[model samples]
Target chain A: MNELEKRLLDGFQRGFPLTERPFAEIARQLNAEEDQVIGALEGLSESGIISRVGAAFAPGGIGASTLAALAAPPERLEEIAELVNGFEEVNHNYEREHRLNLWFVITAPDRDGVDRVIAEISRRSGLEVLDLPMLESYRLNLGFDLQWS
Target chain B: MNGIPAIDHMDRQIVLATQEGLPLTARPYHAVAKRVGLEPQEVIVRMRRLLDQGVIRRIGVIPNHYALGYLGNGMAVWDVADESVLEMGRMIGDLDYVSHCYLRPRFPPEWPYNLFAMVHGHDRGQVLERVDKINAVMDEDARAHDVLFSTRILKKTGLRLPT
Candidate 1:
């Protein structure tokens, strides 16, 4: 990656300007052209180095969100994971090294919507679902420093 | 969310229209306004309000940890007692290596962890060392803990509000 790309990925994790011409604003700060800034961001997104460049809502703020887990049998893990992924409500699902290996995040318009998805998943997979909703947060949005050589 | 100010229907539309991402164009908000059938200036104004209200955390480039060479993703869950959990969580969250930390409910005997700290590293050893540092801070206060390394990402998507 070039200096422009590296600086963009490292520096612009948060506090991106909100304006009609946000790319232009970024260019002003980084000493680059507005077009260069746009091009760099487009390239980063296409290369999978950056996911999105938009709003990140607080969990349970707009609607509701919860972290849930279920211990799927080794042989059924893939099948269960696929099943969980089928739900639009399941935004993130991961297989981790634990008995309760299949973990996922569920978001809904309301708390009941979140619970419905969990109940449906448990019923479909025939496994106990652990609903571990966040109680308190101890961290704020501290940006990341990406020093990839 | 008790203290969070409520947004109206139009604001919700703006969020739905741009939640995936802002356009890569120079006039990104203008494009969002077009999608949501609002004026360009209105989109910018509402988004600003959302940011101030904490309804929207931030608008920015989200780095893909995997692509950036962060191969090991460890979910370090620690069982800290209720009394000290707040201070303990703050200590762990203060770690430079900890990307984010939260206090969640424990399911007891089966799942005896209330504090979750995400530590990303180039490899398992590096991730483990970071987790060890957090453990050191908790000292004897930590009753039990375990680091669950993510083996696979089944799915990942931007947060989609139920429309």
Candidate 2:
């Protein structure tokens, strides 16, 4: 990463300006041109370095969500995973290494919607779903320093 | 769990407008405010208030770990004693490698892990090393632990409110 890229990653993780011409504000702070700053951000997003430039809502603050797991038979894991991923509510689905290998996050506008999705997944996959909603959050922030090696 | 405070219609509109992302423009907030039919100044003020109220965690770039070359990410779950779990969780969460740490409910018979800390590293070995360090920190309080490395991402999307 070059100096400009490093600065972009470090400075913009949080506290991005909330104003008209926000990119211009960033450019002023970094002593770079407005277009350069915008171009760099565009490049970063295009390269998938940053998912998006937006707000991250607190869990359960804006909508209902739950972490669910399923113990799919190894032979049928792929098929069952595809079935589980078919739900729009299932935003994050991952294949982990465990008996309860197929873990996913179901988010909805309300608690009832979350439960409905879980039930549908259970019925469709023919597997028992272990719904583990977050009881307490010690730390939920995902921003971190990008250590350039 | 605390009751969720009801958000007003305007707040809902603001969230809906920015749920995907702020527009990439010289005047992004103005663009969003325009779409939501609110003044740019009002949009900024509302966003600031939302941040203060913990409704909006942060307003910034959300980095993709996998794209940043942190390929090995493990959801390390631990069977820590309930009495010391919170303190242990705080300690684990303070580690730089641990991004998200939460106390989630554990199911009996099949699932016993209650504490979860997401560990990220450049490779599988690095992730395991971090897990070992976490285990060492927990010491005897951690009865058992397991690291479930994600093999594939079936679906990944940001949280979005129903429109």
A60-120: candidate 2 lDDT, tens digit per residue: 8777888999999999988998898778778789988888889998878889999998888
B1-163 per-residue lDDT for model 2 (tens digits): 3554656789889988998788788889989889999999999999998888788878888888999899999999999899999899889888888888989998997899899999999999999999998888789999989999999888888765654
Stretches > 4 Å off in candidate 2: A140-142, B1-4
Q: Give the clashing pairs for model 2.
A: A21-B26, A21-B27
Q: What is the lDDT of residue A27 in candidate 2?
A: 90
Q: Tell me model 2's lDDT, rounded to 2 decimals.
A: 0.86
Instruction: Please compute the TM-score of chain B alone for each predicted structure, in the order given.
Output: 0.95, 0.94
lDDT of 1 by residue, B1-163 (tens): 3466777899989988887888888788888889989899998888899889888877788888888889887999988989999899888887777777999999977899999998988889999998888788789889999999998999998877777
Model 1 quality (TM-score): 0.97
Worst 10 residues of 2 chain A by lDDT: A137-146
Minimal lDDT window, size 10, model 1 chain B: B1-10
Which candidate ranks first by TM-score, i.e. highest?
1
lDDT of 2 at A38: 81
RMSD of each: 1.2, 1.6
**Predicted structure with the largest DockQ when compared to the true one:** 1
| Pairs in clash, predicted candidate 1 | none
